[model samples]
Target chain A: MDHIEHLEHTESPANMKKQIWNTFYVLLVLTVVDIALYFALLSSHSIYKNILFVFLGLVKAFYIVSVFMHMKFERKFLASIIILPMLFICFLIWLALTEAGYTFDSRLF
Target chain B: MSNTATLSTDNKQTWGGGKSPLSISYGKLMMWVFLLSDAFTFSSLLVAYGFVRFTFTTSLPNAIVKPFSHLSHTFTEEMQKAGLFVTERWPSPELVFNHFPFLHGIHLPLMFVSLMTFILIFSSVTMVLAVEAGHRMAKKEVEKYMLWTIIGGAAFLGCQAWEWTNLITEGASLQNNPFGPTAFAALFFIVTGFHGTHVLSGVILNIVIYINVINGTYEKRGHYEMVEKVGLYWHFVDLVWVFVFTFFYLI
Candidate 1:
């Protein structure tokens, strides 16, 4: 018998229809939320606007990474490896951004 | 790489028939690495954009720019109709992509970009369908879904071409833009363009899979393992776009 006769075992998505519909559903909802927030932020200012924006942005990002990217189904160790770097980089980048803001306040351009 | 080794044993050969016995395909593995690197590249671009945005002459693109303030209200009103989001002064996605021919100020490249994002998102959905079809031994349906995926991939490329054209057009040149921060044009063009290139190449690779699928290449070869791997790549592209949409458009 030829080696080709043996079966090839590839991974399959856990729940096809459910995953697809749910991902679209969440994304649709977020887009709506974003639109609404756009109005609220525009009319009258809120002290907590920045916090709200960041919070909502994270929610959207989370769904993309977890559901769309299938990170939720990914192995724990592998997922950790991916997220660890992302977290660290975001932190360092924040510091750099803050430094950039302060640098502009100083002397001549 | 041992001669006796086969995909059935280690699950490497399904990736592609290259060296020793392996289960998965090489192309799929490489795509993951490339995507990871691309992720870092975007991070750096965003970080640099942050620096530029902070140092710019104006208060900020989103905070100032009063006309954009109007769209914020429009978006809020629309969201209220849908019952999906909270409303506020929405920044005009139009000002960002105002160069298109027919849809100039009427919700352009943003609408088209949303179209592109949805195409990729839907392709990911179809890709899963194809994989399932393959597993069920439904060759006709497998080919049907695969073909639809290829068309989806192509449509996304066409959208990108329009986007790039609008970006590089006369008024919208890297030089001028009524809206956006100083570094806004440069960062937006670079980030979005790079992502577009990735989508373009993915279309070609998908074309190859489509060909293989029609020829029943995997059937005789056994197992549609490559589908899983490529599906990952497609989904990742969609994933990245979701962030791009949020950061560049709505927010």
Candidate 2:
């Protein structure tokens, strides 16, 4: 029993507090930018505007996952193991939207 | 038999049976796995929303309405008459979710949801702070931050309830939508409702953990890993909101 150690976890960095606050500011600014862009491109219903918004959302997600969730400090194998599978969502989006376009074309209205 | 004895000596290696390969505890690793699967569930819902939304024409440009202007009592009616809200077109989120609490008819767009986003983000920060405090074994700091996190979560839930009530009063529900196509209201309810349910559970979890902290359970156990585990869950909720805001509101 003495030889068996407690469950292991990665150590927090010394400046973790500062890093947390910095990430907060980054997330805050990115969200503000998202709102600003929403207004700035209000009249343009182009696909590019939607892409830009999604891109910014990904940026915010990165900060949250990397800093707030501590994925950046974790082992690369673990991070990749968790994140790589999410790429399939990109495939799903493309397939669904393409089918949706065909559905849109077929509609009589 | 000799091979078995020799192989046992390699237990400290990457494939070692006695050690975690990822250097993460079983509980934390499972938490990450759960979050990944949860992410997929949310992605599927949002993708369905995108497919349905894509089938409809993009929202018609709005030249008549401006932010902060007077919102007429018949605002939806006016939009319907103006053809801004029609069955063939997807409704712009700004027009649909424009109302704010206690400031009726002011024509605020995306203001309340933005505040909701801010609340969730702020609470996420507090949760991480609590985890940070936990690392230091600072019980008081952990308790304080956990309380703040709980308050933020509760406030966010309150805001969602108000928004839901507002939409319901305006005749938006799963089966009916006065704004535009029925699917618009349906997706809104489903996506945000799902995320709201997650937040509700998160707050409940936070409260439970808060009690355990108050009881000095972690102190007695000689570690605060539980805080870190629940913090992972709290942050995942916030992460889902980021995409929910993007697709449901912004895009």
Candidate 3:
């Protein structure tokens, strides 16, 4: 009976559906923006173009993990446990790019 | 040594027990750890793709032929006449992935892929809905959302199959391609094939869970943790696709 009461007291299904639709709309808008930027920056050699793409991609990724995966509602310690390894991934990216740069230089020179 | 021994004794009292340090269940914690390790595997693959692509592009020769030249013989001739084929270092992804469903022969660059991305993301939303329904112990709602989620997974897999078929039929293989560099075809196949395999497995897993939902397995267990666990995997797959789209196609 207490569990039944708790269910009734919690957020309604309509409210949950609203939140889901909001997230879907946000993701759809981001994707449209991403595709537009892809074409807009197609011929440009600017470094900022790549930076913007990565930044937007990360934002989308964060939303999916946090909301869709419910990581945002998880305990802080659990969130950290899942997210901390990303630092090591960043280190891997840095190392790989640096090595690639060196390889390119050597091949060219 | 004596000081370290004393610290070890103190640590045992506070942290050495078998309790879950993060206050999550053992199953969920294990899943997170598995996903973390899986993330590393994907990161390494994408990093390798970056390294190969950078090296290939920087070292490309002048006057590279357009990709899929054989299929575009007339266009290639016109481009050759216009001296357009004399430009470009590596094959651009926009040109490579331009084919759309049933719009064959039209240059619809990124349209099909964007549609695929939308489907995957929408399916992810359904997955979260399923999890939400599970939390409320709404079995009917859970079943409905889970069915939608399963259909989404299957559809994504079907799209991937179509994409792969087009790639192969258009002359891209692990070893060779009409594309600029051999490594281009190789990395494309490896990274996307790995992801396709994941989606296939995810679809199968979703079907299993959907069946179990219909069987009242979770109701018998008195909780819907299974839905939440599978949701983590599904969301992880979508997360990886976001990175794959950005790194492989957009940039």
User: Candidate 3 lDDT, tens digit per residue, B1-251?
Assistant: 33234334775632444443344566777889999999999999999988876664422222344323333535434433544332224566776687777776566668888999999998999998998888888999999989998899888888988998988886779987665567777888899899988888888888899999999999989878899888889989999999999988887
What's model 3's lDDT at B103?
71
Tell me the lDDT of candidate 3: 0.77
Q: Would you list the rank order by DockQ, best first?
A: 2, 3, 1
Better of 1 and 2 by TM-score: 2
Docking class of 3: acceptable
Scored by CA lDDT, what does every candidate get?
A: 0.61, 0.92, 0.77
Better of 2 and 3 by DockQ: 2
For candidate 2, the docking band is medium
Q: What's the distance in Å from true for residue B17, model 1?
A: 22
* Candidate rank order under TM-score: 2, 3, 1
Model 1 misplaced stretches (Cα beyond 4 Å): A1-14, A43-57, A107-109, B1-33, B57-94, B98-110, B175-182
What lDDT is reached at residue B162 by model 2? 98
Regions more than 4 Å wrong, model 2: A1-3, A6-8, B1-12
Question: Residue A74's C-alpha lDDT in candidate 3?
Answer: 61
Interface RMSD of each: 5.4, 3.0, 6.7
Residue-level error in angstroms, candidate 2, position A76 = 0.9
Model with the higher DockQ, candidate 1 or 2: 2
DockQ of each: 0.29, 0.63, 0.36
CA shift at B95, candidate 2, in angstroms? 0.8
